[model samples]
Target: MANDKNNGQDNLRNAKASASNMYEEGKAGASKMYEEGKASASNMYDEGKDRVNQVYEQGKEKAEEIYKQTKEKASEIYEESMKKVSEAQENLKEYSDELVKTVKEKPLTSLLIAGGIGFIISALLKK
Candidate 1:
């Protein structure tokens, strides 16, 4: 009877040790799973950040291109306006010279014509 009790006690001790080992193994597996999840989350964040930066660079480049085009168009408009102004000045100068020549050729006649135009314009305005 004594030997049988001793054997039963040894078997119980072995079973307890096996249970403790199994608990430790389960805890280690849970820790490993947590670490892997954290690594995956960090990788996803980095990838998202990189994509956003790429998109920002593309947008910046596009804006610069549009700005260049606008500047070029403005310069062209300014040049065209300046050319038209120069042409108008030349036309005014030519008309002035013609008027001066006509006045010099017929000074007395031109004075009479000017007085007659002023009288007619004043009479019309009064009516």
Candidate 2:
């Protein structure tokens, strides 16, 4: 009976030591996982920052290109409008001169045509 009791006590002690060792191992594994997670998160943040900078540079370059194109288009439109305005002014001057000559040479004929047209329009409206 004495020997059996001593063996049992030894077995209980071994079991406790094994349990303590397992607890230590589990704690170490958890700490290692936490460190690895922290490192992975930091690397991801750095990669994201780099991508954002690249996108910003691309957007700025595109905006400058668009501005240059818009300025050139506006200049072309202004030149075309000025050219058209000059042509219209020249045509108006020629028409004005011709009108003055016609009025001077055919005053009575112009008046008679105008009165006849007015009388015809009035007669049609009355009917």
- Measured with C-alpha atoms, the lDDT of residue 83 in candidate 1 is 100
lDDT of each: 0.97, 0.95
Candidate 2, residues 102-122, lDDT tens digits: the string is 878999987898899999999
Candidate 1 per-residue lDDT, tens place, 34-83, comes to 99999999999999999999999999999999999999999999999999
Task: Please provide TM-scores, in order, for all candidate models, with all chains considered together.
Answer: 0.68, 0.68
Q: Cα deviation in Å at residue 82, candidate 1?
A: 1.2
Give the winner by lDDT. Answer: 1
Model 2 reaches what TM-score against the true structure?
A: 0.68
Weakest 10 consecutive residues, lDDT, candidate 2? 95-104
